[model samples]
Target: MPYHIDLFAVFILLGVVQAIFLSFFFLSRENRKNDVNFFQGLMLLSMAACILEIFLMYTGYIVDCLFLVDFSEPFALAIGPSFYLMIRSLIHGSVSRKMQLVHYIFPVVYFFLLIPFLIQSNDFKYNSWVYAYHPNLPFRDVSVGYDPRWLWVTDHHTLMSLVSIGIYFLFGLVEVIRAFKEKRESFFAPVHSVLKKLRSGILHMTSATVIIFVVKYLNIDDTGDHLFAAYISFTIYLTSFNVISHSGFFRQVALSEPQKYKSSGVTADAQKELLDKLAMLMTRDKPFLQSGFSLPELAGKLNTTVHVLSQVINDGLGKSFFEMVAEYRVEEAKRLLKEQPHVKVEEIAEQVGYNSKSSFNTAFKKISGKTPSEFRSA
Candidate 1:
């Protein structure tokens, strides 16, 4: 077989570039705010590394430099965990260190499994790459360079990759569904849109992984490589599409911003007082009516730390910052719609801090069981 860069190879290379740029863009300070962005960056970076391995293999670089091949296997193993963490953080705010360690067990195990292959002599690796897998290739005599044991290693990697991604994909789907339900009940317009985009991306990525895993599991020997190439290319393309479309992933605030309150030692009574003050501030000042309002700004106005305010909003009030803001904005929109019947929907949306009328409508409908128009007409 002649080794050449095909269209799939081009796509794989493009995917690598796109993923790396997105990863770096998300990891940079401008994009880094919350665990969601951090994990999204990790996912994109992992994807770039994995796809780069594929690109190298198809381009025959892996044959020239066998050491580079081992990294791909572990990187491929990392996709499931990275993807899971990204979605989990998007839905759940932040993940615990223990959970992160638990999710990485598969990648760690795969890294150890590749130890034997990694320690092999360069000549041994090059020979194995040329003759161990590819059949009927020129300048490589299969009988002289082939290692029978390598087939088992490759097969194990494939099997484990399938199982890991399948499990995590299902787990991710559950989380997405749970988040959808919560968002519906909570009326968080800003984050609801974010959740919808996140769910769509997760579903697409998960479907691609599932299709590839199922095809590989079926073990169609003749077309397996071709199928793998096509599916992997599709997966990369889908991921690139998602990253481009769901730009909200890059806008999240960091999880560690609330770290200052970890040892603040505020008692229950003090938290209650803060909550009352927060209520008074929201009721009297109507700060949520301000466009681009933030938890830090709210905390500052209340003469409190962001950590304590965040804790009060999340734990004491059982609402996220966005949810609380949406609640107030929706109520304000209701009053305006009721009193100012002649006002335009867009103007009303602008007045209530929703930059988008659709967002305002979504929040209104979610909270009042009617769109702004319907509410006004009633």
Candidate 2:
């Protein structure tokens, strides 16, 4: 087969375009606390690495020869954990600082090990580990040589990296599944299948990594099948795409005790504006649907503060945040039960605001004078 594409240039252009849009999506930046911010920055950095990898491919900077190979050293290494962190954040609502530090261990060690090679190259020379020559023609063969140490480091790094990401995926996958199971028991989301989709995404990423490793082992240490390796690299990058695509990251950001709602000093106009926001959240945002949703969560997503959000829900909505949210959830359950008869009563509990099935049932009974099953059966 003739490998006739300039994958180096094409990959870079494609990645840069995606990164630019990703940056735009991150502009609002709601999850800006501690490890969340770090993970977000890490994602951007990973995408930058992909962009750099592309540059290296086009410039022949990483390879000693004139071709590209399948195994990515530092580039896709960072990208893998970034995906893991994104999923972790989505399911758990936070990142582990200690784990994030641990995630960097192998990549940092690899960078140091490569320093000797990196410094030896100048603008005229390539500072790369995997390279090939005469790619993709029937008569062509690719040749790639690495620092003897790379054989050890890259091999160990691949294993270590895959394990780290698997731990993260397991972390998110378990919580998400558990959450769904609880929701199911409560008779909420009886037919909702997001749980399966989340599991599938994690599995797909793992499968892609495994496939890459198998290809690497067979590709013969970066010298043969350069184009085939490029194909694998492309697959790895696509996996990264799946890891970050979601609305889980979006939040309403709330900052402080707004002077606008202050009883002693807030201006009438300011109070009016805040009241409008409060009304808007209840009607438009429907934050009540979130099970763990609280004043702080709402405020954080809104980029505001708890005191103000509390005041809005209380003073503006004429109810406490809990009551406001609970009321809406009950109404939501009623609507779902009425419209979607096939869904079970346990599903209604989860689909609304209750975490456990029992909690959902209790809340539903308390509010509606009917257990979820009774309500559904009605």
Highest TM-score model number:
1
TM-score, structure 1 vs. true: 0.58
Candidate 1 per-residue lDDT over residues 95-124, each given as its tens digit: 878998899886887677677667767666
Q: Each model's C-alpha lDDT?
A: 0.71, 0.56
* Residue-level lDDT tens digits of model 2 in 316-339: 667787777777788888899898
Per-model TM-score on C-alpha atoms: 0.58, 0.49
RMSD of each: 15.1, 13.1
Error of 1 at 39 (Å): 1.4
Please state the error at residue 72 of candidate 1 in Å.
1.2
Q: Residue 91 deviation, candidate 1, in Å?
A: 1.1
Candidate 2 Cα outliers beyond 4 Å, as residue runs: 1-12, 20-24, 27-41, 58-72, 123-197, 223-298, 301-322, 325-378
Per-candidate total of colliding backbone pairs: 4, 25
